[model samples]
Target: MPHFKLNYFDIRGFGEPSRMIFHYAGQDFEDRRWAREQWPEIKPKLVGGKFTGKFTASDTGASPWLEVDGERIYQSVAIARYLGNLFCLAGKDGMENAQIDAMIDSYKDYLNDARAFFWVKSGMGQGNLEELKTKFDEASKRFFTFLQKRIEKVGSGFIASKISWGDFFLADGIKTTMNFDEEFEKKFPKMVEYKNFIFSQPKIKEYIEKRPESVF
Candidate 1:
């Protein structure tokens, strides 16, 4: 097995799914984190140094990268998919892989909607609470409804009859959105059940219970 090392800031952000992947596979890897204040010193060491202008102080390097041996690989989705393949959890074959990708992409779109509202509107301190909440609800259901329909066809516990990287993505999204609105479990029971199924995995359950809580 190749030595794995994941480097990112000390927060959960995008790097978390990779961590979940590692733990799910029961693979041991380095989870390296840097303090937020240390970025001024760390930015210079990234592949593209900040002074070159190609990378910025705020830039997160191929974050949640999967460092094999000593070579650093970037891109969060690629890393997750690679890890999924390595662990034999990506999918049974090509068609299932496409299904997993579609599910993940939809989750990403759903997440982006909430992210835009929070970062662009809430961060600016201008947005109507009622209107935004309504929008958020619609966005959540639109994606969750799709997931529920698929899971209904796929059967219980695992999507597509077995675990896949898409499960990790959905699990992560559920945790994120629930923080915003806990009522999601009540609103979307099937999606909540899907989240529960992933969390119920022995390795994942252990990691979630033991892992340190961090703010994204």
Candidate 2:
């Protein structure tokens, strides 16, 4: 197994899905959480590090990167998908993989809606809070409604017939959204049940119980 060191901010944001993947696979890794004040010092090293393999940092440099035996990898979904393939949580066929990718891309769109409201609530951005909230609520319903139908079509609680990386990604995303709005369970009962089922996995449940709390 590769030695993994996951670097991200103190929040769950883009990093939690990969963390959940590691724990689900019983893979030990370094979960390096950085404070906002420390990123300037930390990011320069990542961009110019003497890593073994290709380094894939963005132009501005970004968090939620992974160091695999000194080879730097970037992009949240890329890192999570790589880890998912390593852990056999990815799809078995190309079509299945495509389906999973499409689901993840759709989820990203929904997440952006949530972030619009979150930035306002956190006072990091300006907007009418109520207006953003209304937009997010509608977006949430659309995404979760599709998710519920997908779960039913697959005839499994997960996005696929068995556990897949999409399940981890979607479940973690919903968990984060729930922090912004706790009424999700009431608004989308079936989707909430799916989230509960995913989190109920022994490894995941344990990680959730011991994981640090974050506002986003």
> In terms of lDDT, which candidate is strongest?
2
Error at 168, model 2, angstroms: 1.3
Query: What digit string (tens of lDDT, one per residue) describes model 2 on residues 53-97?
Result: 223332336778889998888888999899888889988788878
TM-score to true structure, per model = 0.84, 0.89
Least accurate stretch of 10 residues (summed lDDT) in model 1?
A: 50-59
lDDT of 1 by residue, 31-56 (tens): 98877676566564534542432223
Model 2 is weakest, by summed lDDT over 10 consecutive residues, at: 51-60
Q: Which parts of model 1 are misplaced by more than 4 Å?
A: 44-62, 118-128
Model 1, residue 128: C-alpha shift (Å): 4.4
Screening candidate 1 with a backbone cut-off below 3 angstroms (N, C-alpha, C), the clashing residue pairs are: none
